[model samples]
Target: MTGARTPCINPRCRRTFKADGGSDEVVCGKCFRTLAEAVRSEHRRYWREIRKWDRRILRTADNLKVTRMAAIRDRLSWQLALHWDAEIKPRLIAPDKPESLDAFLEEVGL
Candidate 1:
């Protein structure tokens, strides 16, 4: 009954640490800040990737109408949803995106 392990977020460290809230699991606010910074740093790229996925889905709309491809489309959409939840959504906006990412967008006049 071992718990989960997460990689140490220190940029200079290569070790993994337990992250499952065990009694001995030490928490690190610095790592949390680091993770958030990394996510925010790529906000624009994340949006671009999400838009690309949208266009790809639209292009495949006709194939989805073919009945047999319906299953494949469903599977793809499910996978996409998982990706969105796990990767894409967290980096786009606050309380998701950090202030720096939003400021970056503003600077670009977006």
Candidate 2:
């Protein structure tokens, strides 16, 4: 089967690239591979940790009410989203603040 396509993780060009699905890495036809690989590596690492935390949370929350578990999940998700935006996103953007700050936050449902 064909793989999914996504934009290169480059702020300047943001050219599209085909992701091989086997790996969560994206590299545009252009030589934005370095930056893309770096981004993918970091995201993979972060998501691994997130998964661990999420599973632990789920297990611990088994005895809690659904509402309480949901609230806890929401809090953790938003905090991680904020960190991704403030820490990881700013590096690619030229200015400290991205062109569409509110738009980004809105996407994360923050």
Candidate 3:
């Protein structure tokens, strides 16, 4: 049998390693750098719904902001950023996905 090797998310340090399961790993062992990061990339991967909800909000933020509804747009931006840093960002595990960091964050809910 062959061990599964994946690349780390950190562009500056995109290292690879072997693991039993999981495809397209968000961060590698070395690139994770600290306990906090590891938790975000590993611990938070369990939540699928939260990530999905966040992605939709981020996909059209700029366009939504420039639309007629200014107040609502601002509120959404603030909440998204806040929730990301607090709830979603710390649990990310999809660094190399097709969507931007925002969508990836949503996909992983980390």
Candidate 4:
């Protein structure tokens, strides 16, 4: 099939190979260098956007005179953790899909 190849694991490497559907220990030379990178990319994207939202969250949380930044951070962190576990993790399996950070923020009502 046209879409069956996986990208190389090495950040500097540009390679793609067919998925052999074999054991985890089995990896092509290039993918061995960059395994699970898409997952990392997703987390980075989420956190970057969350930092932007956190500025607003803090301002809104502050205007009401909330004294617990730690609590608010913790709660938002948990919400993001759940969002990643539930929504983002599921789609990582199909990395080629049309997923976007804005869509995730919208999904989480951020």
Against the reference, the lDDT scores of all candidates come to: 0.51, 0.58, 0.53, 0.55
Q: Which number leads on lDDT?
A: 2
C-alpha RMSD for every candidate: 13.6, 11.4, 16.7, 16.1
Residue 65 of candidate 1: its Cα lDDT?
51
lDDT of 3 by residue, 1-110 (tens): 37767666455555676765764545565544544664555434434434544555566567654353445445555665475455533444434446688877898898
Q: Pick the candidate with the highest TM-score.
A: 2
Candidate 3's C-alpha runs over 4 A off are 1-4, 19-21, 35-110
Write candidate 4's Cα lDDT for 55-78 as tens digits.
766667455544454456566677
Model 3's TM-score against the true structure: 0.27
Clashes of 1: 1
Worst 10 residues of 4 by lDDT: 23-32
lDDT of 2: 0.58
**So what's the TM-score on candidate 2?**
0.40
Q: Which candidate, 1 or 3, would have the higher lDDT against the true structure?
A: 3
How well is each residue in 1-110 modelled by candidate 2, as lDDT tens digits? 36667765455765765665654433344533333576656655656766766676666745566456566656666766675566555555443454597968977899
Which scores better on TM-score, 3 or 4? Answer: 4
